[model samples]
Target chain A: DQQVKQNSPSLSVQEGRISILNCDYTNSMFDYFLWYKKYPAEGPTFLISISSIKDKNEDGRFTVFLNKSAKHLSLHIVPSQPGDSAVYFCAALPRKTGNQFYFGTGTSLTVIP
Target chain B: DAGITQSPRHKVTETGTPVTLRCHQTENHRYMYWYRQDPGHGLRLIHYSYGVKDTDKGEVSDGYSVSRSKTEDFLLTLESATSSQTSVYFCAISESTTGNTIYFGEGSWLTVV
Candidate 1:
C-alpha cells in the first residue's frame, strides 16, 4: 500500500517552457509536503515545502501547490533550464507521527535545450 | 548541505554475509534516519533515532537494524545480505526546529549477489 504516489515515472520538457510534476497521497493525516531534487551520485537537496494550513508556496522559480481535498500536490517550475533536469521527489509528513515522512517513487525530469 | 557523511559508499557482498554501513554527522543533529532506495520504490524508511540510545522502526525495517550510540554516529547493519537487498542507502539528519528540512548524506550503494 503506497501512501504516496507519483504516477508519472518520467517527464521531458523544453528549456524555456514550464515543467509540472504531480503527486498524490492516500493518507489524510499528512500535514506537511516537501519537494527535493537529486542529481546522479548526490544526495537529495531540499527544494520547497508547504504546510497543510496553506494551499500553495512559492520560492524563486519553483512553486508547489497542495490540494488537501483531493490528496494531491504538484511542483511547477517556470522557464525550465537545463540545469534543472534531475529526479524530483515528493514527501509528506503526517501530523500524528513525530514528523516522519513518506516519499513518492519520484519523477525524472529532463529539460531539453 | 550539512556535514553528513556516509562511509563505504559502495560495497558488494555475497548472500548470507553480514554488512554494515555507517553514517556520521558533524552537526550533532538530534534526529537521524536510514532509508533505502530501490528502482521502483522511492525512498523507504528503514529506521530512525530521535536521540542517543533512542530508536524506532520505520516503514521498511524488516531486514535492517540501527543504533545511535552518540550524537554524531548511526549505523545500519544487514545481518544476512540477500539479492533483494541490493539498493542504495541514504542517511538523513535534522534538528528539532527544522524537523521537516531533512539533510541527506551522499548515499551508499550495496549490491548483494
Candidate 2:
C-alpha cells in the first residue's frame, strides 16, 4: 500500500507566481517529513523538511506546512522561477525507525517563463 | 551524489534475460537502498541493506533480489527481466543517525523489450 500519496500528477505556473505542491500520509507514526526536488537525469536534492512538532517551516522562498490533524503537508515556492521547475517528492519517516522512509508519488511542477 | 556510483548508467535488455545493477559507495555508509521510479509511482523501495549481509525487502521486491557482500557495494539482480521492469533505478546511501538523511545516485535507466 502507498502510505504517502501525492494526489496531483502535475502543476503548471508562470514565473514569479507561487507554486504549491501537496502530499498526504496515512501512517500515524511518521513524525518527520522531507521534500526533494528532482530534474531529468539527476538525483533528487533535499529541499526543506518539517518536524511534526511544528506546523510550518520556512527557508527563504520555500515553505512547508504540515497539518498533523489532516495528515497532509504542502510545499510552497513563492515567486517561482524557471529553475524551480522539476518533480517534487515528499517523504515521511516514522519516529521509531532508524531513518527508513516512505515516499509519495511526486508532483511535476512546471514553472513557465 | 551521496558518494554513490551506479554502473551502466543506461541499459536495454530483452524479456526473460537476467540483468544486474551495481551500486558502489565510497563513503562506506551503513545503509544502502534500491528504488525504481516510474511515471505514476515516483520512487518505490525494492530492497535495503542495513549492513553487509543484512538486508530486507521493501514494497516492490517481488521479482528482484539484492546482495551486499561489502560495506560499500550493493547489487540488485533481476532473476528474469520483464517489460514491466523498465524504469529508472536509483541507489541511495544513508549514514547512521537517529534521523539520518538519505542521498541518492544519478540513477540507472533500464529498458526491457
Candidate 3:
C-alpha cells in the first residue's frame, strides 16, 4: 500500500497566480516533511521543510503548510512564474526510523505565461 | 546541492546482462540511498546504507543488490537486466538520521533492451 500519495497528477496556473499542490500520508509516525522540485533532466532540489512542531514554513515565493491532525500537507507558490513549471514531490520522514524517507507519486505543475 | 555524482549518466544494456551503477559523494554523509523513477512511480527506494558495509532493502529491492565498502561510495547492481527495469536511477545523501535534507544526483538513465 502507498503510505504517501499525491492524488492530483497535474495542475496548471497562470503567471502571477497562486498554485497549490497537496499531499497526504497514511502513516501517523511521519513527523518531518519536505518538498522537492525537479526539472526535466536534473535531480530534485530541496525547496522547503517543516518539522512536526511547526505548522508552516515559508521561503520567498514558496510556502509549505503541514496539518498533522489531518495527515496532509500543501505547497503554496505565490506569483507563480513560468520557471516554476515542473514536477513537485513531497517526502515524509518517519520518526525514529533511521531517517528513511517515503515519497509521494508527485504532481506536475504547469505555470502558464 | 550536495556533492553527489552518479556514473554512466546514460546506458543501454541487453537483456540478461549485468549492470552496475555507482554513486560517489564527497560530503561524507552517513546515509546514502538509491532510488528509481518511472512514469507513474515518482521515486522508489531500491536500497540504502547507513554506514560502511551496512545496508538495508527499500520498498522495491527485488532483482537488485547494493554494497557500501566505503563512506564515499554506494553501488547498485542489477544481476540480470530486464525490460521492466528500464528507468532513471538516482542517488541521494543525507548527513543525519533526523530531519536532514536529502540531496539527489543528476540521475542515470538505464534502458534494458
Candidate 4:
C-alpha cells in the first residue's frame, strides 16, 4: 500500500561524482513530485520539485527528471560534495488529496571524500 | 526556519499512558501537519489542520488525535501509548494546500515502553 517507493535503502558514491537517486510511484493521480533532504537530527528540507507537465527541472546542482509513463522520477546531483550526504526522500502530491503528500521510505546517500 | 518548534524534543512514557506533543509556529501559516517517521516508513501523516478547529485525519491517524484551538499552536495527543507508537514526530507548516512549500520543525522523539 505504499504509493511511493524508493527501492534502494542506501547508496555510496565518491565526492565530485554524479549521484543519482530514484523513486517510483504507484498512484497515477500524483501530479507533483518533490525531493527533501534530512540530516541526522534535523527535520527534512525542501530540495527540488517537478510538475507532471514538465519532464525535467534543474536548480543549481540538483536536477529532477520525471517520466509519467513509468511513474518514476530521479534526482541527480553533479559534483556531489560531502555536505550532500544525507537521507533523501521523494514525495508526491496527489491531486485532490488536499496537499497531504505521500513520501517514500527514503534513501540514505553517502558521499566519500 | 519557518518559525516552527516542536516541544519536548525527546520523551519516554509507559504503555497505556497518555502523551501530548506540542507544535508552535510563529509564521501563522494556514496549514499545519503532524507526521511520524519510522524505520521502514518515511513520514506518515497523522493529522493536519487548515484553520483553527478545522482538522482532518491523514493516512495514519488511528490511535491519535489532534487539536488546533489557536492558529499558532497544534497539539497531537496519543490517548494510550503503545510500544509500537515509539517514533519521531515532525510538525510541518504551509501557507496553502497545493503548490506551496512546507517547512518542518526539528522532530520530537518519543519512546514508549
In terms of TM-score, the best-performing candidate is: 3
Q: Write the per-residue lDDT of candidate 1 for residues A1-113, one digit (tens) a residue.
A: 88999999999999999999999999998888899999999999999999999999999999999999999999999989999999999998888577577899999999999
Q: Give lDDT tens digits, candidate 2, residues A30-80.
A: 998999999999988889999898999999999999999999999999989
Worst-scoring 10-residue span by lDDT in model 2 chain B: B93-102
What TM-score does candidate 1 get on C-alpha atoms? 0.97
- Write model 3 residue lDDT over A1-113, tens digit each, in one string: 78989999999999999999999999999989999999999999999999999999999999999999999999999989999999999999998988689999999999999
For candidate 4, write residues B22-75 as lDDT tens digits.
Answer: 999999899999999998899899999999999999989999999999999999
Residue A66's lDDT within candidate 3 is 95
DockQ by candidate, in order:
0.65, 0.64, 0.87, 0.78
DockQ category of candidate 4: medium
Measured by C-alpha RMSD in angstroms, how accurate is candidate 4? Answer: 0.9
lDDT of 1 at A51: 92
Better model by DockQ, 1 or 4? 4
Between 1 and 3, whose TM-score is larger? 3
Estimated TM-score per prediction? 0.97, 0.96, 0.99, 0.97
lDDT of 3 by residue, B1-113 (tens): 68999999999999999999999999999999999999878999999999999999999999999999999999999999999999999999998878889999999999999
1 against 3, candidate with superior DockQ? 3
- Model 4, span A1-111: residue lDDT tens: 899999999999999999999999999999989999999999999999998989999999999999999999999999899999999999998777687888999999999
Sort candidate 2 into its docking category: medium
Candidate 2 per-residue lDDT, tens place, B32-67, comes to 999999998999999999999999998899999999
What tens digits encode model 1's per-residue C-alpha lDDT throughout B6-66? 9999999999999999999999889899999888899999999999999999988998888
Model 4: interface root-mean-square deviation in Å: 1.1
What local lDDT does model 3 show for residue A68?
91
